[model samples]
Target: MMTLEEFKEKNYGKRGNTERDELEAGYENFKIGALIHDTRLEMGMTRHNLQKK
Candidate 1:
């Protein structure tokens, strides 16, 4: 089995610094978008309502 560091480097580049940064940034946005999307659904919000907010 590979170590965690090895896996990260293999998938995310050397030490995963660069790719990890990109992944983190994208994930943060994704999380925010998901939260907003879920909240909108719960509130029965339409696209227009979301736009107006």
Candidate 2:
């Protein structure tokens, strides 16, 4: 798995284009959200469970 910095460098740095930059940002956000969801699920934690903390 790519670290966020590596992902950004490959997708949004000097070699990147405007369209790709936007898409990469969105993709990054989606990946973060999915990771959070997956982690929570694995821990048997729901939104409400999280909110209680």
Candidate 3:
């Protein structure tokens, strides 16, 4: 298997545009999860407390 450097070099080409583009497409769910997690922390809420609003 290629090292991460080699893999990134192969898939991301010179400027990392391909991998960055792919990551951009998948970033929304992560953003939402982080927002929810941060809000829960701010509100002192547990995962159990936040279920199904």
Report, for every candidate in turn, its global Cα lDDT versus the true structure: 0.84, 0.82, 0.77
Q: What would the TM-score be for candidate 3 when compared with the true structure? A: 0.54
TM-score of each: 0.70, 0.62, 0.54
lDDT for position 13 in model 1: 76
Comparison by TM-score, 2 against 3, better one: 2
- Candidate 2 lDDT, 14-49, residue by residue in tens: 436786678768989999999989999999999999
Better model by lDDT: candidate 2 vs candidate 3: 2
lDDT tens digits by residue: candidate 1, 1-53: 99976876778877348877787689799999999899999999997998998
**lDDT of model 2 at residue 28?**
90
After superposition, candidate 1 runs with Cα above 4 Å error = 1-9, 14-16
- Who wins the TM-score comparison? 1
lDDT of 3 by residue, 1-53 (tens): 88966765676654448775675556777899999999999999999899947
Model 3 clash pairs?
A: none
